[model samples]
Target: MVELKSPAEVEAMARAGAVVAEALTAVAGLAEPGRTTADLDRVAADVLAAHGATSPFLNYHPRWASSPFPAVLCVSVNDAVVHGIPTDEVLADGDLVSVDFGAVLDGWCGDAARSFIVGTPRPADADLIAATDRALFAGITAVKPGNTLGDIGFAIAASVRRDGYGLLADHGGHGIGRTMHEAPHVPNEGRRGKGMKLRPGLVIAIEPMLIGDGTEDYVHDPDGWTLRTASGARAAHSEHTVAVTDDGARLLTL
Candidate 1:
């Protein structure tokens, strides 16, 4: 069932979202050539600690996962689509890094992700990132009372496809609150006005993952977590936690 958060619960979630933003900011600041992905993970871990927040990602074992997740942050790079585990692999000057993290504060959960280049970015990579971010905004824009879930999906898919980018299928955002994942799974592409109607108190994560070469095909990394482009194309992802309110959409992770 889709569980809605009370106004006070939503406010508490914003506090968790703040911690998530801080961790993402610190991770972005520390991401550079010569630093390992693990290094960025440490910075995020520290940020969560400083805020007295816990990671919902740590030790999380989903039905599809081979084992419990061992890291607080998922740092995907270049062709990796999502859930890239942090390792000692050194980042290169032109690597496109995407970090996905979540924080739980006082039992509320906030999740977000962003893709960026380590140093100077290739024109194509920058475009991919921009398209992904724009798609995320489009998705967030659809989060309002009376809008359907399909509207959110259509908005995001249209935004990315207009820029000649493709998105991974089946992997999208979800309802979030006391738990990181909740009901009312939100897709990145859908027929407008075909799904659940958006209502006040509905809180969710809006994320868009765009494929650089304009194809939905992707290959799963043997790690059972990381997913990569099947055509060896690069990808970018962007996300934010948002709440559907009486007035409009309220971004908790801003």
Candidate 2:
């Protein structure tokens, strides 16, 4: 069943969202060329600690995974899409890095992701990132009372398709609250005016994963987590946790 959060619960989630935003901001600054992905993960852990928040991603074992997740951050570099485990691999000058993170505070959860260029950006990398960012906002704009979940997905997919980008169809957003994932899976593409109707107090994480070469096929890394483009094309991801309110969509992770 889809659970609706109370106003007080929403406030608690906002606090968690603030921690998520702060950690992402701090880690983004440290994503330099010579730093290992593990280094960025450490920064994320420290930021969460400073805010008295706990990482929701740490040691998280989903039904599809073989082992517990090892890091607080999903550092996907270049062609990787999402769930890229942090490792000792050093970042290069022109690599596109996508960082996905989540946090829990006062029993509520917040999740978000961002993609950025390390040093010198390669051709079309900035465009790819911008497209995903735009798609995320498009999804957010579609969240309102009486609007269906399909409306949110259609808006996101329309924005991505306009830029000629390919979305990771199998993976999409999800309802979030006390748990990291919940009911009412939010896909990135769907028919408008269909699916579950949006209502006040409903909260979800809307994320867009776009590929530069317009391909949806991806391969999982041997580590049983990381997902990379099957054609070796670069990808970008952007996400934000939002709440459907009486007025409109309130972005908790802003």
Candidate 3:
């Protein structure tokens, strides 16, 4: 069942979201040519620790996974779409880096992801990341009272598909509360004006994963989690946790 949050709960969630946003901003500043993905993960963990917040992704074992996740953050580089595990891999010029991080404060959770270019510009890489960022905002605009889940999905899909990017089918956004993932799974593609109706006090993470030059298929690496594009084309992901209020949508994860 979908649980509507109280004003107090939303306030606490906003606190959690602030930590997540600050963490992402810190990590983004640390991303540059020659930095290892693991180094970026360390930066995020240290920031969260300084804020007295805990990472929700650490050792998290979802039902589909064979084992618990072992990283504080997801560092997907280039062809990897989402759930990319941090490793000793070093960043190179023109590589597209996608960082997915989540933080929990006082049992409340906030999740977000961002894609960035390491050094010099690759036209395709820049364009792909920009498109995913736009798609994320398009999905966020649909989060309001009375709008169906499909409305959110359709807005996301329409934007990315128009740019000729592939919408990821295996992974999508979900309802987030005390836990990382919850009910009302939000897909990247759907028919508008359909599915569950949005209501006040509902919080959901709307993420868009767009593949620049591939199909919908993804391959899991040996690390047991990182998913990469099947066609080796670059991928980008952007996300934000948002809450529907009496007025409109308020971004919890800024």
Candidate 4:
């Protein structure tokens, strides 16, 4: 069932979102060439711990998975779309790194992700990251009382498609609160005035994943967690946790 949060409940989720934002900020700064995904994972774990929060991804075993998640973050390198696992693989120059993370604080959850260039980036790669980032914010802007989920999705799709990138098909954002993933599957592309109407106390994660130059199709890696582009093109993802309020959309995962 789709659940709308109370104002006080929204405040709790905001606190969790703050921890998620800080964790992402710290990990992003440390994500340079030569750092392994595991290294960044540790950074996020420590940051969440300091805030008295724990990783929602750790030991999380959603249906369709055989084992619990063993890492604090999803680290997808170039050509990888989402759900990338942390490994011994070291980041190299000019690589595109996508970090997806979540935190549980006082029983609420916050989830967000971003992709960035490691070193001196290629013009195309840099452009993709920029577009994806803008798309995420554009989607968030559409989250407000009375708006439909389609408004958010259409905004993101229009922003990225204008630049010629393809949206990932299989995965999208979701409602997040006491649980990691909840009702309201927020897609990256949809028609405005469609889907569920937004109301005060509704919190959702708005993310957009764009492929550099390929179809929307994606395939999971052999590890059972990592998702990569089917055509081997680079991908970028960006997200933020937002709450619909009587005033407007407030970003919790800033």
Query: What's the C-alpha lDDT at position 97 in model 2?
Result: 95
Candidates in order have lDDT scores of 0.93, 0.94, 0.90, 0.91
User: The CA-based lDDT of model 1 is what?
Assistant: 0.93
| TM-scores of all candidate predictions against the true structure | 0.99, 0.99, 0.98, 0.97
Candidate 2: tens digits of C-alpha lDDT, residues 8-69: 99999999999999989988999988999999999999989998889899999999999999
Instruction: Give candidate 3 misplaced runs (Cα > 4 Å).
Output: none
* Candidate 3 lDDT tens digits, 174-234: 9999998888798887788899999998989999999998477889898788898989999
Q: List the residue pairs that clash in candidate 2.
A: none
Candidate 3 lDDT score relative to the true structure: 0.90
CA shift of 243, model 3, Å: 0.2
Can you give the lDDT of residue 139 in candidate 3?
A: 91
Score residue 177 of candidate 3 by CA lDDT.
Answer: 91
lDDT of 2 at 143: 93
Question: Tens-digit lDDT track for model 4 on 10-87?
Answer: 999999999999999999999898999999999999998898898889999989987888999999999998988998
